[model samples]
Target: MGKEHVIHTDGACRNNGRDNPQGAIGVHSERGSISERLPASMERHTNNMAEHAAINRGLKSAPYDNNPVVIKTDSELCQKTFGGGWAQQWERNGGRTAGGSKPANYDFVQDTMKEVNYRRSQGQDVRFEHVRGHAGDSGNQRAHDLAQQGLGQGAPQYKYGGRY
Candidate 1:
């Protein structure tokens, strides 16, 4: 196996839960960083949607080799959805929650799960870790900053770094 890679992801929403809320997602890793506002095409603009989008983007951006990838996120909802079998149960029920309704952020959840299953199918070890937000973790802080930046940007930003 190759060296493990760690990625930090975050989401932010200005005016969250109100009309005209704006959402963004941030992802940071040794390879690069991404900061982008959620596409306007999405019907809902909420913090949870942004969080799910961040995880999906992180999974899509991860390397597709045998190396392990660890994604750190502050959102317990994201952690639980991916790691606590919520996603599996939702999938088993045809993407409906136990309440017989589609889960919130269904599109993002499906996208994230698709990426995870694809990576695992190819022998990649993917994991998600829950990290306390705003606790001075540099990676998390950086990702948070990137998400904030997305809230101000004209276009999505992608910055690359030398591979580790």
Candidate 2:
């Protein structure tokens, strides 16, 4: 196994859970960083969506090599969903929760899963670590700041190469 690559991701939203919520996702790693508004195509804009989107983008940005990649995020949902088998179980259950209702941010969850499955197919070990938000972790702080900055920017033009 090669040295692990750590990428910190975060999300931010303005006026979340209200009318016309705007959200953004951020990704930061030793290689580079990304900050951009959530795509307009997303049906609803919420902080959770932004959080999942950040993990999706972060996974997409990971190198296509054999090195183990660790995704650090403040969102425990993201960590558990992708790293703790929630997605797999949800998928096995036809993308529905145990209550027979669709999970929130289901599309984003699938997108992240696709990236993770692809990376694993390529012999990459993907992991997720939960880092408490705004707790003075430099990488998480940088990702948070980037997501905040993304709120002011327009939608991203460059594609990170994913199905969704």
Candidate 3:
């Protein structure tokens, strides 16, 4: 088996749900890292949305190769929504929850599914693992710090450029 390529992603939303809420994504990989704030006019600036964007962008920008891609995140929702096969079931169920309710964050979930499937079809193994937030793990810490930058809390510690 080839070596794994690890991608640690995180999102932060300052004043979420309030007017002028801000969000951002932080991506850390062996190649490099990225810290990006959400667009100025985003309709929703929730933490979950920011998390979804980080994971999606990480997958989208990951290098296409034989190595497996492990996406480390603190959001269990993202892990369960995609990795738990709920997304697949939701698609088959016409995007309804088991209770017949419209699923939340449908767009982000759908977009993530597309990116994951496309990567799989390209021979990349993608996996999502939930990491505890604020843990001292180096990668997770770096990602969290970058996320803070996304929220305009501080400057990014690393230059942003790489395989993502």
User: Which candidate has the highest lDDT of all?
Assistant: 2
The regions of model 1 sitting more than 4 angstroms off are 157-164
Clash tally, candidates in order:
0, 0, 0
Candidate 3 Cα outliers beyond 4 Å, as residue runs: 153-164
Better of 2 and 3 by TM-score: 2
Among these predicted structures, which one has the highest TM-score?
2
- What is the C-alpha lDDT profile of model 1 across 18-93, one tens digit per residue? 8889888888999898888887767768998888878888777887789998999999999999978899999999
Alpha carbon lDDT of residue 144, candidate 3? 81
Each candidate: RMSD to true structure?
3.9, 1.9, 3.8
Q: What would you estimate as the lDDT of candidate 2?
A: 0.86
Which residue window of length 10 is worst by lDDT in model 2? 155-164
Q: Which of candidates 1 and 2 is the stronger one according to lDDT? A: 2
* Whole-model lDDT values for every prediction: 0.84, 0.86, 0.82
